[model samples]
Target: MRILLVGEYSRLHNSLKEGLEALQHEVTIIGTGDNFKKYPVDYCIFPKYFLQNRILILLNKILFRIFKLDLQLAEKGIRFWLFLPKLKNYDVVQLINSNAIETYPFFSKYLLKKLFNQNKKSFLLVCGEDTPIIDFMLKDQLKYSILTPYLNDSNLKSEYWFSLKYVQKNYRDLFNFISLNVSQLIVSDLDYKIPLPEKILIPNPVNTNKISFDNLVISEKIIIFIGINKSSYIKKGTHFFEKALAIIAQKYSDKIEIISVENIPYNEYINLYNKAHILLDQLYSYDQGYNALEAMAKGKVVFTGAETEFIDYYNLTEKVCINAIPDVDYLVRELSLLIENPEEIIAMGKRARLFIKKEHDYINIAQKYMDVWNRN
Candidate 1:
């Protein structure tokens, strides 16, 4: 079947496209131009630079005040017709609606409704609880696809209300709309009162193609976690890992080296992972991020989160990646053990790799998508 995927945030479409094509299905990916690199498939480009879309939207808002034109409505009106011809042509089209301000086209409920009405058979793929218009656009859907983890699942959601203040009210309203409209909700198995169309637990997809653990020669070196940014502590557990590192590094300073090249470009990172024997994933959030998964693929043992659900998902009671707070004392003890027993560490790393291959390997996950699409 010919499929068109729209939006390119989180690089998910690329992974999905790669997986589907491997499954012998035709997939076409489209996204904003200029920001993307050479992807596996030539994606659709809706050209809008930072200055162009933001400035245009702001100008329209100013115009709204002068002419009393429902500027938001007016812009939505123009884009609906402008984009419909291109959008309505797909057999299955996935709209990647982001919560960011720039995703105006994806946010237009009326446009999506019109397109869906025009073509009733198109399988609408909506990801995350983002977009203020999801419920309105997909109010009749008997199901939902929720990818992002629960808002309160991590400690970071304490700022959710504050973050909501910046988004336009209508946009924020969409979260509740999705809650009301969805018949089934797809999400991680976390303890949260998220309203669901029906609760479906689908863990995040792990890309095993980029990750590997075939032939690893252990090196006596410590590698700081990659893919961690300023928010790593809050979202991916940067601080927690760092604190544990402080404890672990005290005795192993001469034996194990720690380096955090979080800002390294994508390709270079894998090479670094190849060199390191261990990867510190996250101290705060859920177990093994995509970064942790990548490290495991490179044959690095990760020491990070082990949330109750994640522990159950993998049945990992003996934390290979010791999940502990920044208590230097605790992390130091855990690291000492790993550095002392390299074989055990490698064994755990192998387990990590196996878990990723069995669960997140995008190829298998993509096949699952096809199976879902071609159901009885």
Candidate 2:
């Protein structure tokens, strides 16, 4: 079957493309390399450096307000319009999100109309914050959510206010348009799945072949790595992790080495943490996000979201992952325990790789997508 995956964020679609191709299915991915992360795609829509460069970006902004035209949007609109003729009669077309093209509502609706008409089947992934997800989160329904940090701190609101406002008003038409047209709504992680209970729950696809597992034997100081994207620090509960790390480092400065890398490129980010004994990932997430999953596949002991629902779903008795919550005291204690027993860290890392192999094997997850697409 021929599959056209629209947009790329979090490298989810890339992994899905790999899995689909491995099963002898034709697949193509169109994306902008997910902004700064620079994940690869078959067809690239990322703009030139002038549009992204600081000085030139300011000039583009000035031009945008004067002419009521955004150069980035203009480029994407033309490119996608020209590409539309080639997109028809696919077995399936999956959108990375409702606003996959990152265009205004009018254009988003136009693109959705064309996509729905062109493809045999259309599906939307509820991976990021969309109208429905935001609406659901506003209700405070979840036991704990990524919004917890933002809700508690007004200072953080400034960073996410534009996104919050968009979902509240500007995005409704496009959201409804896609929801009505798509064959199904699919969610890979519990964060999305919780708010969208009716959507199909498909495990995230991770290409295990791409990640290598090397068990490091620690006789001296154990290295713990944490990478922070400044924009997401508060939302991801990085402060909690940082506080815990501070305490842990102070107590076991001789036995533990804490490495924190900030806002690096995707490949470099992965390479930097490759030698670490433990990887500290997001704390407030309800599931292990793409980064944590990738690390786990590489046999790194990842401290990620292993909430109650996640543990119960897998029937996991052994701690395959260290569940890092939004509590500094809890984090400090867990890190301290692991530092004292280096052998247990090795054991947990081994289990982490096994859990990912069993639950998130790319081919198997891709088969699930095929099953759903074929059925619909």
Candidate 3:
């Protein structure tokens, strides 16, 4: 099958491409490398000059402020329009999200219509923030979600603009357009799945072959690592992790080492966390994200979302990873348990690797995607 995956998210599409190619399918990915993480893509529409040049970037910001025009998004749209001919004629085309091209809603709709018309099948992946998920949150459907912090404190409104924008008329219209064009909607994880209950749920793919599991050896201090993306700091509930870490530092200064980093490239981020015994991931997730899954595949005990729903879905789980919440006390307690019982850390790390192999193996996940695409 000839597959065209539009946009990249936390290396999900790249890993899926690898698996599909291994199964003798031709796959092409076009995206902006997901910002600073820099995930690879076959056709990159990244606004390099606009993003890299200081003057241009300043001008772009000023233009947005004055005229509500984003130069970078415009550049991306133009680039994607130029690449439309080559992007067509695929057996299947899957969008990473509603705003896969990261352009204005009207421009995105226009470009997507062209791609959808040319492709044999069109599917939308609900892996991140979109109109439906935002709507679900706004209605207070979930017990708690990524929007919890923002709901509690309206002062964080600025931080949530990206997500809140999905509730606006323009974005809602874009969502309706995509929904009408696409064959079906697919979700990547429980976070997205919970909101869009009717959509097909497919777990994120992880290339276990590339990520080798190393048995954790903790002879002295238990190192804890956390990587933060400034843009998502509030949405991801990173402050809760920070507060928990601070308390852990004071109590277990001699027993543990805390490493915190912000806004680093994907490769560097992974390499830096390799030595740590524990990796602190996002708090608002109900299932593991790409970062946590990759770390789990590497036999590192990760503090991430392993909620009851996730555990029940995977059944007979022996603590594959820690379930992180927004409470600082809970986080500190979980950390203390792991620190006090280092053997469980090694045990959980082993379980985490096995869990990834069983539940998120790239080849298996890719095959699942193929089945869904073919069935619909």
Candidate 4:
């Protein structure tokens, strides 16, 4: 199968591409930059046409009106549409939503579906909450995949500008919203309870192999948090993580080591994970994102709980990490428990690594995608 995967998240590119190739499928991950020399891949540098000035905006409007330019979206909107043919040639197009950028592209996608003629179908893989999914599906029977869906709370300020109109008129429109146009909804956690009729539980695209479980030693006293975005704190309770860690460090004195892998490359970041005892995944988001997976692959205990749905699906109650809310007191108690039972922590650490390897190991993720493509 020729799968044209579109997105810029590092996890999506590394794991999904590697997974697909292992299955002997032609996976071409189209990205925004040309820095893919380290990996065998193709880079599609779509020009950014963000309008900054009124004069240029006016000029672009005139050019668009005269057919001098193709303004399907803002400007790059037209450029993305140029790849509409690529989507047609491929068996599936998993549209990964990065930081809510899917809003701007919907205009191009809607226009292209109308203007372009295609033989094959391309599916939109929403990062869980793309308001436009309701619009595109309702306005024109389109449905997409919800990979790692957020809880059914759309109050956060994404590209939708927090509008309820973005939701379809009724539940009848929701029928198409489930699949938009894809076969199955690729999900990382079974914790999502939004009534997905065609939900396919899959591993999040995490390259667990890159990190080694053998490298984690109990002598390491470091406590680590790897968040790439501060905005994650607002939703995932970054402050809570910080406060909890503060209490542990204060109580343990020099015994507790804490580090935040915010801005760094993979090698440097993984080194911190190697030198750490615990990994703090988000408390706000119910399911762990790629960071937690990475830490787990390193045989580190991730301090976050899976949603009830995910827990029930896996029959998972324990054997790995401790699940807790953002309450500093709860986190402090969990840390104390781990510190007291160092052996248990190590046992859970090993279990966490095995969990990631058996579940989200990039190879299985790729195979899952293939299954989705083949309707299995």
The TM-score, computed over Cα atoms with residue i paired to residue i, of candidate 1 is 0.68
Per lDDT, the best of the predicted structures is 3
Query: Which of the predicted structures, 1 or 2, would earn the higher TM-score when compared with the native?
Result: 2
Regions of candidate 1 where Cα sits further than 4 Å from its true position: 32-41, 44-48, 51-84, 95-107, 114-168, 176-185, 188-197, 207-210, 231-233, 314-329, 374-376
lDDT of 3 by residue, 1-376 (tens): 9999999968999999999999999999999998898999999999987899999999999998999888999988988998998987899999999999999899999999889888899999998899999998877766678898888899989989999999999999999999999899999999988888888899999999999788999999999999999999987889999999999999998999988999988999989999999999998889999999999999999988889999998895489999998899999999999999999999999999999999999999999999999999
Q: What TM-score would every model get versus the actual structure? A: 0.68, 0.94, 0.98, 0.73
lDDT, residue 95, candidate 1: 54
Clash list (residue pairs), candidate 3: none
Candidates 2 and 4 compared by TM-score, better number: 2
Model 4 misses residue 361 by how many Å?
A: 3.1
Per-residue CA lDDT of candidate 2, range 1-376, in tens? Answer: 9999999878899999999999999998887786778988877777764466888778778988898667776566566776787888898999998888776678878877887787799999888778887787777777667777667776778877645854655588788888899889999888888787788989889998999988868978899999998877877889999989988988998898888998877999999998899999988777899999999988888899998888887899999889988888999889988898889999998999999999999999999999999898
Once model 2 is optimally superposed onto the true structure by TM-score, how far is the C-alpha of residue 25 displaced, in angstroms? Answer: 0.6
lDDT of 4 by residue, 1-376 (tens): 7776665554556678877787788877655531222223363534444354566667778987897563423444455556556556676666554211222434534633542235344554544444543343323221211211122334443523322333634322332433454445554553332333355556577776566567456674645554444434454566777888778888887666677756455555666667677777766444566667777777788877555545665677575666656578988898888877778777888888877777777887777667676763
Best by TM-score: 3
TM-score, cand. 4: 0.73
Off by over 4 Å in 2: 53-55, 63-70
- For model 3, the stretches where C-alpha displacement exceeds 4 angstroms are none
Q: In lDDT terms, how accurate is model 2?
A: 0.85
